[model samples]
Target: MIELGKVEYYLLAINVIGAVVYLINMFLYRHTSNGQINVIVTITFLLGGSAGMLLMMLFFDRKAVKENMMSRVFVICIFIIQIIILLIYKGHHAEHVTFAFWKFFADHRMLLIYFGIMNLVTFIVFAIDKVNARAHRSRIRIVTLLGLLFAGGSIGGLISMYLFRHKTQKDYFTVGMPLIIIMQIVVIFYVMNAGW
Candidate 1:
């Protein structure tokens, strides 16, 4: 019989609460706008952690999930972070989980740095493109934007799209970016699981 600790209990409680909130919002507030509902669901997933994210994904409001790229990206990111933390906990069995996280961070410092730089560059490019669009100047190409997204900048691209309201209405952007993110997540999980 494995005794659960405070962290385990807390994770379980949050997941249960998040699922309840999701179901309540889904059934009782069916008329709410996707944006509003997404806000609530995103908050729920953030609080609920990985299990909550999985539950929401499993029992998602399909229309909402389809329409809201930013929310989807945000939820995926939260899920990835929580999963990484859980993996670190399991790997090190450290008394302090933070130590485990720090160790992992140290081990993957270069990869993290690369992602940080790529995201920053992508964000700046998106901002520049938005400015260009506003000023009637030459703009970045769609191919370039998609390329950046493919190169570990999907998070930055999605965030910039939301913040700058650039290309938000375009089907390619609305659909493509999330798909890229999901692919990236899959590749990452595969690489990690493969011990590469």
Candidate 2:
């Protein structure tokens, strides 16, 4: 088991506080401007670490996640910085650090499973939407499709779009799907290469 030191513990505490603040703002305060909220959230994310902020963005404020590209990029950058710090610390304490790609896979098996399931679901939803479109039935909402794509289903979404010949004309899907895929790929590569 990895033991967290004082700095890590303090960072965790700050992250928890930041998450609480984010929740309160999301649930109780409706008067704040989007820009103001973004600034506050970004600052907290930077100071406290990004895992909590990312979870909040993914689960609580997906609309902002979808719309605020700059904030998303900033959060991702913060996450990268956190990873770099971890790598540097591990380098200093090399005896305690044993990193490999397979080790990462083993450690994060559940996350991989979640992604796999999400991708399958995204594909099915896209297929259903296409069938509905052909049958002149109620169509799936674009937001739902985009949400799935954003939530670790970009690969499935891209395949479905091409296989089903659906939503190909929409610039958002054509552009955004690939962009998300690229971003995901870059992050994965960075993690895989960080120490392994």
Candidate 3:
């Protein structure tokens, strides 16, 4: 068995704390943007053992959703449909198809833990810039932030937006966020299987 040490013990405690905090924040997310993430989907994502999305919710100001009530309803409809499709896709190969994704993630828990840390560090840097970048504003510099925003840190970027009251705008999402989500998926998949 692996030996326990003070530093390792402390790190485990920190990770558990971080996971709980992120989970609490997730339920609070309902920004009037892309849509509220679906419950089944969010549960699957969480069970899939990835904490990145949960951490993302913690940083967004759900109240800033610009549209009115009807818009939210429309968004919700789309959101549910998208989630259903994602679930079917991820769980397609398993007997309990609805939960196939969860089993897969459990099998690759190491990669999920790795992904969680990657998101946390990137978000901290983004959060720092969210506080410091306003005065030095230039389109080019802003572009770079947007580019980084598209680099597997959508959750962090979203979190930074609300926590700093920064980058919560629509376009930052229309382009940057989706790209980052795609990139994150690709990276996670690579990391999950690259060495095996």
Error of 1 at 152 (Å): 0.8
lDDT of each: 0.70, 0.72, 0.48
Model 3 quality (TM-score): 0.37
Q: Which candidate tops lDDT?
A: 2
Residue 54 displacement in candidate 1 (angstroms): 31
Report the number of clashing residue pairs per model. 0, 0, 2
At residue 50, candidate 3 shows an lDDT of 31
If scored against the real structure, what TM-score would every candidate get?
0.48, 0.49, 0.37
Candidate 1, which segments miss by more than 4 Å at Cα?
1-105
Q: Write the per-residue lDDT of candidate 1 for residues 73-184, one digit (tens) a residue.
A: 5555567656665665666333332324345546789977888898999999999999999999998977588778978998998999999999999765787788778767
Instruction: Point out the worst 10-residue segment of candidate 3 by lDDT.
Output: 68-77
lDDT, residue 182, candidate 3: 58
lDDT of 3 by residue, 1-196 (tens): 9997774565455445545544444443433444444554435443332333333333442332333222222233333334444444444333421324456579878756765665676577666666566766432344445545544456766676667766556554444455456555544443343333
Q: Pick out the ten consecutive residues of candidate 1 with the lowest summed lDDT.
A: 92-101
Clashing pairs for model 2 are: none
